[model samples]
Target: MSESYAGKINRKLLKKRRIINAAAGREPADLVLKNATYVNVFSNELCHADIAVAEGLIVGMGSYSGMREVDMSGKIVLPGFLDAHIHLESALVSPREFVKAVLPHGTTTVVTDPHEIANVMGTDGIEYMLQATEGLPVDVQFMLPSCVPATPLDESGAVLDYRAIDSFYDHPRVLGLAEMMNFVGIIAGDDQPVEKIVAAQAHHKKIDGHAPDLVGNDLNAYVAAGVYSDHECHDLADAIAKLERGQFIMIRDGTAARNLEALVPLLCAKYADRCMFCTDDKHPSDLLEKGHIDYIIKKAIALGADPIVAVKVACHNAARYFLLNNRGAIAPGYLADFVVIDNFQDFTIEQVYKRGDLLVDHGVVRDFPAPEVEPYLAERARNTFHVETLTAEHFSEHRPRGIIGMVNGEITTVDAGYSDRIDVEYDVLKIAVVERHKNTRHIGIGFLQGYGLKSGAVATSVSHDSHNIIVVGTNEADMAAAANRVVELGGGIVVWDGGAPKAEVPLSIAGIMSDEPLITVNEKLEAAKDAAYALGVNPGIDPFMTLSFMALPVIPTLRITTRGVFDVTQQTYV
Candidate 1:
């Protein structure tokens, strides 16, 4: 804005002042790009213009008079990329860590889902993240996590009701509700103590959706329910269907990188209207090696999407769809959020500007403060231990609780299945939940299968939903020793066998992610994953990812949360 986020221009007064001062003969242009072709996503028109930026806003954009200008001469200028869907804290610990990872790719702003941490620590976690990202190289706006546990089916750490959602509405950095993952409950007509959709509607905030593989009548009903956007489409047809229903389809490529290739076709002129790009959930390894939203733009163009179409998916459409009038374009009064490309192919970044200041030059964060955020949830690592039994009877004590199945890479999962109700003769399965909090001796036990290793035990504090310690074993002694080690080391995911732990990754921060640098952590985690492969665990499409979602009652087919088990088809706890 000429006056910094000013709503309306005092145009008549300014026009009079322009006559009196003559703007001091245009002054000296603070920065100028000479003879660059502007990729106007709004008009789909290519124009050669000399751009002048002053006071951080594009004060003049036209054929230039002789002015001080950087020699752009032949480079292209498109609006900087935007990540319409992503979770930054989930991707890495701090904003600088993430900006270091993706800024060179031309992504200058991100719409994040912080509901993951909010699920564990409630409002406190949300504020910590917000304070940490106050003045970053990129604009960091949050969509208040719609569901803290994500759904009422589980015992999530905290519940964010309508009032809680409303309380954050005017918070300077807040956008709207994060992806509303509970489509099954919404469609099944379940009215509990509170409805997330009701909160979004009352506050007039956008409610992002997460409905994977929803088809036929259910998909149509979900659209009508007033959830406006989704990033969970795995196929092109799914993207097209949701776009047809007026839901902005966020083509996502997170750690798993689904839908980047499958749905690039939707950026077709027929449907480019509602297309956008998102990272959804990326581990730091992926963020470091593979680019963020810029990687998607290149992939889409490589897959034959027009360069303009790809840029629109990454920038224009997200802004237009959500009515984020302040950005998504390089016009007057919009945020000074744009990128100056050094070159296009292989995409070398030159400089980045956010809120009208040069913050990143040649991919390095410039003049920014590193946030001093302490690991506040340090005690939760000790609380991770809970259940105290080792025998098969301990797991089966409560009528065979739900077992999680995972299919690596795919985000959704198969429903929770029943453990065979045997006469206690055969060694079938056992599962455990290691509390990553300060309960080292506590372990939650249950029975499960599908990893196909009942003769041995597979243990991990990476249990989904509550992030507690979960181990599945045939022998009580093996399960006990494996679960005990996680508590001993504070918190981590581990696997074990008869006498010793096979592999482990200590995650001291709320049991979900590590405060340790991701590269160090992912290397160890991958080593453990490789070990699971040697033990006959099928990776790349195994029961791990599916098991995490098994507890998520939001996605269809079936899911299980920290609760006993959710019958998503019945929209009730089984």
Candidate 2:
């Protein structure tokens, strides 16, 4: 590591300095941020120090110098934050216009699981995501998806297997396996898919797990089976239990979940080392305003978590767990990834850096790479533009209608929770799934619910996993019309009143996300939320979220996914 010996480095730099130091054999860094304050997340101490860089690597430290210097006086520096789990492809592709929403929040990296796109376009979808995130501000690394259709009962865009896993495991950015959602299969020892885990094991990579409400001997079986992490814990006792069982708890905060408060207390008291933070699935509006994992750090601190411990769980622990040494701490031999924040309580981000490159500054992305994506519109906008043609015929008691009962601002659902059934004879209820995959298959039927929808119909192509078209109504024609309108409008959510359409939020990308900017997406989201309220749905949250994840078959107490109806407890397709 000398000046003359520097040319051999790949994507790194070489520099020469005078420390009259021992022959440790080292070159100078490319750039040096001289005289900065370090918030040592490891020891929770603040120290005034100088950082040096060689090529893109931190080759020197402790009052170091280089060719050029960035005088960071009185500025706060912490490690780059990591987003433990996400769906970058769906996040970027579905809403092509919203990637920057999370970039400015000091979260310089993400461990994304591209299952949403996999369900739509299969392995091709994963490939598309890989291609799309080239050289973006944030390090969009991946965990090779563990579940394609997500559940065995549903048919989706991709069918990933041991071959596909082995194929993608070699890529530099591919880190181990994605969240394994097939808890039942793992417990049953059905190794067809579980072998994928074994394959990653051979590669010596980490394994991420997902088992909602798994407890007692079953939880034991899950952890003993080689799965290492869990993010689906809902209750504090369950989270603490999982932590006691030696599973790293990734406390989650997202559009459908607000578990940070419940899980934060544990991370503060007793088991601080065994926890991390992740946004399982966050919409643009949430990411843009509330934040990525940065919000988690702020929330943890606000709830009595030590600042250093909060930053550790928010930044260092996740990278350490996944063994992503390249980007984590602000120390020498690590990537020059960090955030300059004004405070820890509100967590205001002033600047962000990754691999020594400045990405976001002053609340805006200084640079953003373009992503090329094809829109997946279900049908034209006008095709689904009619109102109720019902005279009370869609009701029943035994053949219960598939209903999506939502929890406010959360993705967890009360599956098939209804005492009422579709009265088909009276034309009171109808349910439909529009094939938003652009395959052009649209189907409609009638259903019932105890959640109580008094009028009109709600439609969306935001169905989870498969993201097919989903419409619920009292009238068959209204349901069919709402579904077709999503197709005709090039994909979006359609709301219908008596004999007319009220509001249509056009989500041109795959019928699930809007290609519009973050602000526009939020506006449309509010409109849809309002429309849902007008329809007599009691859940105060925006309807888009409830509609978007309705097709997700992974988590369950109950759900009405695009693949007909699912019985999660029995682990079978009904």
Candidate 3:
């Protein structure tokens, strides 16, 4: 027999023998949780039982004695929640810091798309994230970024081709390809995307989808290209259509885009099996205030979803879909990853254990210190922020044809038609996207409303997709100062007023993530928000987040880039 086949048989037999021994009282379990009402996601039932674990796998789940045991009289045990899709870099904290913020909330696994970091540092960035997450309490699985720049219309620091991505498929934590944001290219049968899809499929890896508002034959064409999942559905109709077409819909509840409420109606019995939950992009403030996947579960239950169904969506669905064969349940041979809660209604987590080890106790993360980053990885942060010398004259708009209107919550923008002259009095402020990568000296200037910046200016190197320098302000000099300040700090978010920086958050890791503790980063971010509000930016809007999305051309209506104003609906620059 072949070596692979022999190994498979030996593993199956070994598991069966161990399970039998543990159940028959012939072997003592490593750990046991007695008298717990654990959820059975497969049967959709809550059964009172004792769980026996050994070597990080559940060997038995019945009456059993163990070397260590805990009495759970009334608590509910649940499979650890999984975030189907997320961008860890968007939290503005390094992977170590990001896990520290979310693990206490019972998110054991997160499928992260590192395209944000990939755009800035390429494969090295992806490797840094992977290395940082090693041995952490949270299982951070990676999806190789499918589109580095997101599209050719924008310039990015690094470019990842199919050959480059093929090398990462063999990594243990790399699950599959990230979202294919280049939907236009996929539909046009572009050789580059097609080959990437083919390469992933050959390895039997999953391909995530990113078609926002795409429907009809175009949707069919994109699906036919082997994209298995999508998290970009903004409405019920879109969700329904994609579900009917055999696409797994990931209901997203993120920092800027809150679609869970709008799409929760689709989480009913008929379609619950085809749905999962993800936070495609989230900020630190939201993660801290509202719990991670726990927040989604509570909200879904409050909105009248069956508590078990919501649990399935948060846990089982993602694991099965992602082919994480050893997890997603509390059963024999499954990884001993679970959360202890007071009840299903409030879902108040009391403790969390991963791989049979206590990671969080009573809502506090246990002692699992983050590893020191390799010196070579630290060196990658140098020389990233590269913007040409910018001045107030570069931001001045004369006879502008159109303005990029900001929507409060969504990434998409609206193209409010042309204006004859500058109008800062009406809250119409100047917006500019400067090409930071390669120092192209390219600047796209336009007018924006709804920013509510009465004075001063805000800038960030965390621009989505392209990772360029984006600044918005009422005063040209402040805007110029804010933009250049971000460059001088290597890369970060900055707020400038009175011709000086009022507050700044330095993201030294590829201009997107800070290596500092999450608490420190959160403090800096809060300070920046305070400064933004002090400068008369809208109180309801997250000024930094809203400013970041302004340069993403992939989203609808209107967006600005170093090239010029882009009309997403028209699919061309105007």
Best candidate, TM-score-wise?
3
Candidate 1 weakest lDDT stretch, 10 residues: 16-25
Once model 2 is optimally superposed onto the true structure by TM-score, how far is the C-alpha of residue 237 displaced, in angstroms? 2.5
Per residue, candidate 3 scores C-alpha lDDT tens digits across 1-574 of: 5569889999989977776787666998888999978989889989888999887888878898898999888999998999999999888888878888888888999999989988988888888788888877899998999998788778888889999878899999998999998998999999889889999999999999999889999999999999999998989999999999999999999876778888999888889999999998878888889979999999999998989889889999999999998888888888899899999777889999998888899877876778666888778765687777788888766766568887776566787877645577887887888988788789888778888888888999999888899988877888899999998888999999887899999988888888788878889999999988988888867888878888888778889888778898898877
Q: Is candidate 1 or candidate 2 better by lDDT?
A: 2
Error of 3 at 347 (Å): 1.4
lDDT by residue (426-511, candidate 2, tens digit) is 32354545444435343323243433355777777667777666777765556656666776765677887786778887866444
- Candidate 3 stretches with Cα past 4 Å from truth are 1-20, 396-401, 419-421
lDDT of 1 at 21: 31
Clashes of each: 40, 47, 0
Best by lDDT: 3
Evaluated at residue 61, the lDDT of candidate 3 is: 82
lDDT of 1 by residue, 428-514 (tens): 355555443333444344444455553455555544445555665656667667666766655566677657777777765555566
Which stretches in model 2 have alpha-carbon errors above 4 Å?
1-30, 65-68, 89-98, 371-429, 434-455, 498-501, 553-558, 561-566, 570-574
